[model samples]
Target: MSVVIPVSADWLTLREPADAAARSHSLARRAARLVHPPAVVHDLGSGTGSMMRWLAPQLPAPQTWVLHDWNADLLAHAAAEPPASVSDVDSRVGHLEHLGADDLSGASLVVTSALLDVLSADEVEAIVAACVRAGAPALFALTVAGRVDIDPVDPGDRLFEAAFNDHQRRVAHGRRLLGPDAVAVAAELFRAAGWSVRTDASPWRLGGDPALVGEWLEGWLAAAVEERPALTEWADEYARTRAAQLAAGRLRVAVHHHDLLAWPA
Candidate 1:
């Protein structure tokens, strides 16, 4: 039994602007240099094809994309809305564990966004092995670093943050999730495998969007309470206060994430 987190297409749409802002431009440029015209790219965990929409324009045109995800709905949404620059759009439905050199063969670049933290150490290792076997450069972006700062701080903020980070690291179905530790571990593994790796900070600085903030806060607090049952009472009060502040446009949030670029050394 694997840990499954259901993501709504609507939520992915809501975060597109911020995701575009948070991705590293330098890494995208570096990845562009390694490929020739008509690049063949594979986006792992390609939720709603956000990675393709955000990245296709930065590189040269006549690009081909293979979107990989286990969810049929997400794949459908992605296939329905491909970027204009993409010459071809294809979908593969399966887990990352099923990915192999054969799947990535003839690919110039492999990419994923906001996906690393959900994986266990073993899963990430397998991904690295597959990328290495395929001799493909990879750009993994927006993996959570487990740090968030909310302005107009309340007493319950740290409590919830700590609990939420703990929740991220929880084991489900006998596999321990990497959570905030994902970036460092992945960098190390890629380096050990003789790939040149670079990292950059891509934190989301959110303000002026009360609806998005409220939705994000709800999920953040819910996970905290689920991790520690004792946090339920405090989390309820905290959620109410946060909601009120956000509704009044008195809230700002900073969510820290890291992006990595790896190429064969």
Candidate 2:
């Protein structure tokens, strides 16, 4: 059995702004400099094509993007809202884990955002191997770094954080998700494969937006409770208190993440 985590278009839509803001522009510029014109960029786990919209302008013109995702609905949404700068867009519906060098061949760059952490170690290795074989540089962005800080701290914050991190690393359908360790693992793999890797902090400094923060808090607490059921009672209270703080404009959160760029050494 394969692990399947369903993602909604609403959730993707809600987070797109924050995702765009949190991405490392410096790293994106570096990636842009490395690629030649007429780029064929493959964005794995394309997720409504947010990565493409965010990155296409940074690259050269006459660009072609192959958006890869398993969800056809998301692909449809992506295809409908193609980036204006790109010359053409192609959608491939399938498991990105099954992708090989041949699939990525003729790619100038490979990219993904908020995707590495959800993948198992072996799956990540496969993607890295494919990138190497295709001789393509890669920019993997916004992978969670397993550290989150909420302002006006609560004692239960650490409790929920630990559990949530554990949940992120949980095994589903025989695959252990890499979670917070994803950036380090991927950097090591790229380096071992003779690729020069650079990583930058891309944490979301979330505040002033009640909807995004509240929704993120809800999901974060839910995952924590799911991982450690004993925290259910505590989570309820925590959620309520956080909601109150958010309403009062007192809640702030820094959800840490990393952006990694790798290229031939």
Give the candidate number with the greatest lDDT. Answer: 2
Per-residue alpha-carbon lDDT of model 2 for 1-265, expressed as tens digits?
4434589999999899999999999999999999998899999999888999999988888899999998999989998866777988899988977899999999999999999999999999999999999999999999999999999899998999999999999998899999999999999999999999999999998996899999999999999999999999999999999999999999999999999999999
lDDT of each: 0.90, 0.93
- Indicate the worst ten consecutive residues by lDDT in candidate 1: 1-10
**Model 1 CA deviation exceeding 4 Å by range:** 1-3
Best by TM-score: 2
**How much does candidate 1 score in TM-score?**
0.97
RMSD of each candidate relative to the true structure: 1.1, 0.9
What C-alpha root-mean-square deviation, in Å, does candidate 1 show against the real structure? 1.1
Estimated TM-score for each candidate: 0.97, 0.98
Encode model 1's per-residue lDDT on 50-120: one tens digit a residue.
89998998878899999999898999999897788899998998888777889999999999999989989
Query: Which pairs of residues collide in candidate 1?
Result: none
lDDT of 1 at 66: 93
